[model samples]
Target: MTSAYWPLADLRIRSGPLELRPPVPAEYEVLADAAAREPHAHPRIPFLEHTADTPLRRGRRTLQWLWSDQGTWRPDQWSLTLAVFDQGQLVGVQNVRAAEFARTREVRTGVWVFQDRRGQGIGAHSRRALLHLIFDGLGARRAQYRAAASNQASLALARSLGYAEDLAPLTADDTVRHFSLTADCWRTRTDPVSTHVTGLAPALFMFGIGHE
Candidate 1:
């Protein structure tokens, strides 16, 4: 996709101490290096055999998948994957995706932080920024998220952000927990909010929203 085709170009969000934006091509290596150094950054997601040692390759692959034209770009089937920055350095990745989305208007979010950055409240702030992007900027009706059953940190983050528990089926691994959130519920929370969102109107239109 051309730079102009990137829907989230120039979009940004801040929550307390974090900023979230689309990853520049030049920053991919930085993001990859951070991930390579911290496999525990995302405790719930399992690492593939080549993932820990080959983060640059993994980062490239993720970019390719996100930008692929063959993949559905409808509001429901698309994901806006962003790099999380702390004081201008790449530290993590966050994603908001829809499944069976056209009919549901519901999105799911996931996030990861560098190993060294844990306990600094970066994850929580980054996630809140993404929520604003989806619920306010993108006009999404609701959002959902899941964490591994054993990922206490993720569960805590979800609860802290007002995501209610949902009964999900047992995964093959039996370690996943599901959570859901509504826009109204999120708006009621009193978290600090900061963001710079540009091109959101165009991006939302590209995703099928007629009026922002």
Candidate 2:
């Protein structure tokens, strides 16, 4: 499972009881199927499941999107869509993305946990793993998150993680709330979730950063 050409495939992050790693093409269908089962998990999210389409079609669209995301990665702008697993079982997907990372050192993240697994704290563990990857492993200065104002669960999670409202420009949709956490806030936090990241040293270049 080693990728000589794309070391990102080797990246792994562990937090609590979860493991987050880069998704392989063969597992795209599994991710899509998970999403298909909970199409309306977040009504405002721009996933294909929101459309009035068959599950198969929605899954197909999800596959295409995942493929496109991996294919379009670049140093200046890229998205790392990691497949989340709990004790070796596919649970969902978590995405952490950045633009002009070399200069801004900021990243944004998104996640989709299946409806059946919503209340079990899986999302929190998944996000803690991702935050560790960006702030600790990648040396990110800030991490941002946005959720529809109506999505109380997501907003509550952001607040719980010590994220504060950010005065960034409003999106076309005013319903989305923005929050950001600075590296100082993250590092000095009293309640830290233990996390470990591996295989990232080899993929540093792909993320537009060098070993510090």
Say which candidate scores most in lDDT: 2
Error of 1 at 164 (Å): 0.9
TM-score of each predicted structure versus truth = 0.80, 0.91
Full-model lDDT, candidate 1: 0.70
Residue 185 lDDT in candidate 2: 92
Model 2 per-residue lDDT tens digits across residues 1-212: 69888888889898767899988878898877876776564653446436466777667777887987889999889988898999988888888899989999999888788778888888887887888888889999999888878888999889888889866646666778899999999887753567889999988988888742
lDDT of model 2, residue 168: 67
lDDT, candidate 2, at 131: 84
Candidate 1, residue 104: how far the Cα is off, in Å: 1.6
Itemize residue pairs with steric clashes in candidate 1.
14-194, 76-101, 149-175
Worst 10 residues of 2 by lDDT: 40-49
Q: Give a tens-digit lDDT track for model 1, residues 1-212.
A: 23565555766676656677777767766655554555433444333125244655555554454455225566546767788888877778788877665467788788877778878888888888888888888777888788877778888999999999876544555667888899899888876666656556656655556543
Candidate 1 positional error at 168, Å:
4.8
